[model samples]
Target chain A: MAEAVIEAKGLVKKYGELEAVRGIDLQVAPGEIFGFLGPNGAGKSTTISMLCTLLSPTAGTARVAGIDVVHDPARVRQKIGLVFQDPSLDDQLTGRENLEFHAFIYSVPAEVRRARIDQMLELLQLTDRASSQVRTYSGGMKRRLEIARGMLHEPQILFLDEPTLGLDPQTRRNIWTHLNDLRSRTGITIFMTTHYMDEAEYCDRIAIIDRGQIVALGTPDQLKAMVGGDVVTMTSTQLDAAAEEIEKSFRVTPTRVDGTLRMEVPDGKKFVPRLVRELTVPVDTISLRRPSLDDVFLKLTGRAIRDEEAGDRDRMRQMASRWMGRRR
Target chain B: MSVETATKPMAADLTIPVDTRAASLRAIYIIWYRDILRYWRDRWRLVASLAQPLLFLIVFGSGLSSSLGSGTLFGARGGLSYIQFMYPGIIGMSILFTAIFGAMSIVWDREFGFLKEVLVAPIDRWAVAVGKALGGTTQAMIQGLILLVLAPFVGVKLSVLTVLAIIPLAAVLAFGLASFGVMLASMMKSLQGFQVVMNFLMMPMFFLSGALFPLTGLPGWMTVLTRLDPASYGIDPLRRVVLSDSGLSSAVVDRLGLTINGHVLPIPLEVGVMLAFGVVLLGIAVVMFQRRD
Candidate 1:
């Protein structure tokens, strides 16, 4: 097995009474694409911040690239590249200028700085637009440029926070392709967070966090396997009656969720035909499908991953209190 | 396999460079360079910042000089033009405005997310504060130098010695004001919020620093306020250096010099206080940033 480039043991971050990231442990191996999957306010970003040394953990310890983040943050910073959740590019600067400035900050050798920047620009397919101001680029181009800038210093590990947050499907796919290419070429460890389950499919391993704690951890297939079978879902006018009939006939308990009868079976396709024929209550619709990350998340957290603005106020309140805590 | 072969050699030797003193200095230089690049690119900003100060110098100076000239302000028995006195204050005003606005860009950077990029870099947090202070100080000093070209027209002395003295003197004041700007901007998250607070404090600080009026013959309350203002020291020395060598009477020079409890502030003391203020304010800014994300 490859060695772990990132290790966190019982890491915790609390703001007043709110534990944004409760005790959690993580170990990401070198060259592994590790995914942190969670819904909004699930402490994904907070964990990233602690690992990146942008925020101090209230308790526990973390090491990035074999350096303790809190003890030697500068060294960790040198070893890792971070692309923040927000757009951190200087809009006033051209792509090349931004990379040049970043290279200077990282103390890349003067002899190789120019060639390295050129190589990064070419790798990101931004060689032509390298001279154009970032303000004029499309969102995808800007994202690609930011990734390029992050990689300019040749860090051993790269942390990307919501790498594909607000891009189109094509751009998102392009980004994943670029990330995959970079991984294959450089073998640099990648730790990224995203609410998008589809994006998590690209990871070698996934950890599902919810309400500041990890609820599940494994590869995409392993996570789905934990659901144990295909998901058979049925909507009926008499959902309670249907659920009882399914349990009686199939000897499997069916969960009633939001006016639907849902059950996990070894072979949902075969069971659906039997279920339709055997059910006593009038079933309106029935469907059988493979378990997805969304279903895994739903089963674990009892909720679907949604783009929620309702939690924004709560998150802001948590941030304000965190800022106040830092002052002390 | 072909792609890995092409890139692996370059990526394989990932050197973990320690963050030494030289790296910190390099960080400062890079950050300073970025600020300078932005300033140079936005030529309109430099032009626009000069407009308000020029208005104060030309329109306000001429308007006030006509009314206040014959009144023996600062004990000018030989009828020294009020513009000569107002020129130094205008220079101070330019420094205050440029320095504060330069500092306000920090709020803009924070809002735009660039501040986070700098904060997360491997360098010392103090480097960011120091680089920002130097950037703003340099920008404000440039504005002051531009304004100095108009000094002769306003009846202030313009000699080799005077020019040599004013540049560093203005730079010292610029450093103090810029450091003050960085301190206030460090706590702010939004440009609108920073602007609101800056406007509230800036106008009062300029007015109370004896930049627009003589400190002598003031009421006890105003005297206390002026004496307490650090900008007062900055402005006094600048005004003294010009007036003392402008062939003004010793009596008039004594009246124009800044005094606290009837003792005049020496030029060296004034410069020293400004330098100390710069250092302390920068220290506070660095501490504040170290605590922030």
Candidate 2:
């Protein structure tokens, strides 16, 4: 078995009364791409921050590159590179200057710094824009530059916290391509947190997080297998009462997705006969499809990830209001 | 996904050995050098620093000198030209302001995540603090010197020898102020909070330091306040050097106590005191920063 490059045991973080990260345990092996899948406010960023030594855990321990993050954070930082959700590059600096600045901060040798800067520029396809200031670069270009800066030190482990969070779909795919190339060429372990289901599919292993805890951990196929079969989604005018009746007769769990009722059965086509006969209300439309990451998320959390996201937004608003009241 | 293997070389071929300690020092130098380069590129910032002190000299020196009529308005010190008396005070004020503002950049750095990058690096946190303090002090000194060059143009005359002698004193003062600013920066969490403190605390400290006028002119209560001010200690020696024909006095007998001769020894006692202040402030800043993580 490969050695673990990053590990966290019962990591917890709290902000006053609110527990941001309730106890999460994770392990990423060397040369592996481990994706942390969660909706907003699911403690994904908090966990990553603790592991990277940017924030100390309230209770628990983490180790990165064999160094105890809490005991010796500086040592862990030396061996790990972090790409924050926000582009942290200085806006006033040119692309080349930014890499040079990062090289200095990481302490690469003078002789190696120049050559590495050249290699990074070429690798990120930023050679033409190297002389231009970062403020002028597009979003995709800025993200690419941030990635280049993170790798300048050649750390053993790289932590990307939603690296492509706000980028266009085309730019996100480009970032994924580069990420794959980087892992293959350098053989470095990658620990990334992403909300996008398709992005999670690219990882060798994924941990689905909800409400500050990991609900499931496995490969995509393994996670899908847990649901038992294909998912059948039916939209009805009376979904509230009909969903309960369908569940009773079908002997399968049915979750409400927006205004639709969804259920997973061994064979959706064959099960449709029983579902229609058992339903007390008329169905407006019916659709059958294979199980998806969204279905797995809903099955594990008992609510769709979208609903959890909205719940978090409301919680954040309440927290903000309390803080402002205290200030006044 | 295609697991396309590279035909070039294995991991063994790319392995290169390095000394960890040496690498960390190199990283610190990079952070320091970049700060210096940024200062150099911002010509307007440099101009503004020089202009502030000159404005004081041109506006305050001329207006106050004419009103005070070149006599000993304070009644405690010897009769001297107002322009000569206020030159050193302005220089001290310039040094103090520049140092404090220079350290204020830490707030910007923190907000932008630049400070976090340095804090998480392999090197000691003290090294980062030291680098920042050194950079801020150096910038303050350069700005102070530029004002010193414009002194004669603003009607404050001084011999080249006197100017040379005062540069070292200005540098010492700059280092002390910069260290204090770093200590404050580490304590304050946000840019807005720090700015408010700077305006409320730092501005009053400068004005009450007797930077623009002698302590004797103020009311009795204000005079006592000035004695307790650290900026007073800084400006007193500098004023002595600029106004007196004997260069600067080593001692002065006053009602409060005997002001020891700052110029008597090989290195002035004031310089030693300022150095001690810098060391203490720097120690506090480093301890605070390390404890924060």
Q: Give the number of the best model, judged by DockQ.
A: 1
**In candidate 1, what are the lDDT values of residues A1-328, reduced to their tens digit?**
5668999999999989999999989899999999999987789999999999888999999988878989888788888888877788999999999998899888888899999999999999999999888999999898999899899899988899988877888999999999999999988899999988889999999999999999999999999998869998889888878788788889888877667877889888789888878777888998889998988998898787765542464467456744553244
Give the lDDT of residue A272 in candidate 1: 86
In model 2, which regions exceed 4 Å deviation? A10-23, A56-61, A240-253, A269-282, A307-328, B1-28, B70-80, B158-160, B216-224, B240-267
Q: Comparing to the true complex, what docking class would candidate 1 get?
A: medium
TM-score of chain B of each: 0.91, 0.79
Clashing residue pairs in candidate 1 (N, C-alpha, C atoms within 3 angstroms) = none
Candidate 2, residues A71-169, lDDT tens digits: the string is 877667767888887557777778999898778767777789899999988888999999998889999999889888888888999899988876788
For residue B97, what is the lDDT in candidate 1? 79
Candidate 1 chain B weakest lDDT stretch, 10 residues:
B10-19
Evaluated at residue A163, the lDDT of candidate 2 is: 88
lDDT of 1: 0.85
Candidate 1 lDDT over residue span B178-221, tens digit each = 99989988887565566577667887889988888889889999
Q: Could you report the DockQ of all the candidates, in the order they appear? A: 0.52, 0.33
Lowest lDDT sum, 10 consecutive residues, model 2 chain A, at A319-328
